[model samples]
Target: MVSKSSPHKSALKEKEGISQPESIGKNSVAQIIQFRKQQPSAQELIDGILKGDKISLSRAITLVESTQPKHLEKANEIIQACLPYSNNSVRIGITGVPGVGKSTFIEAFGRFLTAFGKKVAVLAVDPSSTISHGSILGDKTRMEELVKDENAYIRPSASGETLGGVARKTRETIILCEACGFDTIIIETVGVGQSETAVHSMVDFFLLLKISGAGDELQGIKRGIMEMADAIVINKADGDNIKKARMAKTEFNRALHLFPPKSSGWQPKVTTCSAITHDGIAEIWEMISEYLILTKDNGYFSERRKDQNQHWLLETINEQLKNHFFEHPEIKNLLEENKKAVHDNEISPFAAASILLEKYFR
Candidate 1:
């Protein structure tokens, strides 16, 4: 008996008359692997990104997201080089519950911006699966047209175990996108209605995206998120849903009025839009433009960016300290011992943590 050789199939002894050929040729596979092996240097990536090269921009962001220590140093160099070019872009953080047409709305909005020569970069952060550790949403695929646009860039990232993880990487990616000449940065965060969210702290404008019929949904959302919203866009207002959308707009506007005025002195606006029909898309941009004007004139724009910088400064410190603490060889071994000790009630959790911290410091 002869053996069958099909890369797609498990190795088996041939009993049949014929065997299928390899799905992909070995030469093709080698070429693909060789193409992927071409990684540009940090300086090259930075230079290409500054020249508005999307490939380089994406590559640099990949470095930023990598957990490897070597990648960290390169990521830092790219960020430090790009910092001066950043903070000039309009950073918008958008959030909504699942199935709210967030992707559809973004495509319409992004296309509208690019119509006027604005370079838009979208960072859609999907909730990472605890088991798979991969992004569940295909935002780039959803925003197909926008993804094809030369002026628009859509990069979806996975939200890790905590909000802080998303913040550090996404915030750094924003800098890279801005340096890549994307004037408008849209960060789509995971879930709805979290208080003092990482996205809220990093963006200049926070927009809450929602559907028309969400009465029960409102209860699930926290007031803190509503107060943080610069605008509420009720999407999918086409057909019979128009009336419900308008009603939702009115309800959101009223609810917004219930809160005290924003420090920006710019009132939060509620508007209805149909992401499918592109209705009210321009009006939404007009509203955002009004906001930008008001914030800039009142000096809130620059002040808010400064505040965000300070917040990120502290956030980075906390993240690095935590990483440093756990990465210590003594702490990793001691942590396991401490965990067992605490589980056995042989030592208090505080005492174990104290012992680990002392060892880490030493």
Candidate 2:
């Protein structure tokens, strides 16, 4: 009673007179502004991306793909803000056998789609050398016409030892492209065996390209890939291979029937096309649209996307965990020692892995 009111009054006055923690707050704001100045503002870049500004989109993709810690934080913030504006674009993954002419197909398909007034973004994932960690970066040169098209945006990325011929950053790059308002996104994966499954997980539709007369169609690809594809296009079908292409298409069509139907409740189709002459490109696009309509009507379209998101989350977590494990100095030493042990036959491969894992947990 004697001091309660007095103390409260004094405290209020002291609080009003005292300086606050403005220095830290001011520094943070200044840092954010500086970071923004160093990188493109997400909102501004996103706006340009939506308007089909190729330069802005390229810059935005590069910002997202940057390895700088600060740039990564900004990229995350931008993606978070742009998430609501995303998911409006169609994502298609295209893969083929090494000589199946994936680059040619993408160029022809991209030009065809743009001709219909749709903006297309092509993201090519090139295989990186395990020894040098460098990529050939050849997509732009292969798709010269599409690269020059104002309505088409082409970005080539290195897989960097990642599985599935897709970059670890490809998913994030896809989000940036969608946020920027690309109507369609085409992910072109390096024609690696079995690893093509990675691209299958991210796309709304998976199209596999195979050249006719490559021996038995099944010989050219694993059965697992054939099962995963929504559509199979026998490429190089224009010249002397037309008959063989048709025969190959029939073989695939028959093979497709043996597998259990997709969980998406849609049947996969097989077709033939020649990417070099641009023959049957329009038909392939039409089939894609038809598939979309059928899936959307059946309520499988959104469900498929949700499933892809879940798969991506798991993939991202596993990738990060692997990176962290390999980067730890102690783990690196252990791995090196284990490799030597295996090479010298001092330990079985399984035992070596077990020893390393035991130490990893410690």
Best by TM-score: 1
Give one digit per residue, the lDDT tens place, for model 1 in 304-358. Answer: 9989889989989998899888888878888999999999999999998889878
Model 2 residue 113 CA deviation in Å: 0.5
lDDT of 2: 0.83
Q: Which regions of candidate 2 fall more than 4 Å away from where they truly are?
A: 1-38, 41-52, 218-221, 329-362
Give the per-residue lDDT of model 2 (tens digit) for 243-360.
Answer: 9999999888888888898877889988888888888998999999999999999989998889888888888788777867777788899999989999999999999888877888
- What are the lDDT scores of the predictions, listed in order? 0.86, 0.83
* Residue 272 displacement (Å), model 2: 1.9
The Cα error of candidate 1 at residue 355, in Å, is 1.6
Candidate 2 displacement at residue 251 in angstroms = 2.2
How high a TM-score does candidate 1 get?
A: 0.90
Q: How big is the positional error of residue 74 in model 2, measured in Å on the Cα after superposition?
A: 2.2
TM-score of each: 0.90, 0.81
Q: Any runs in candidate 1 off by more than 4 Å, and if so which?
A: 1-28, 192-196, 216-221
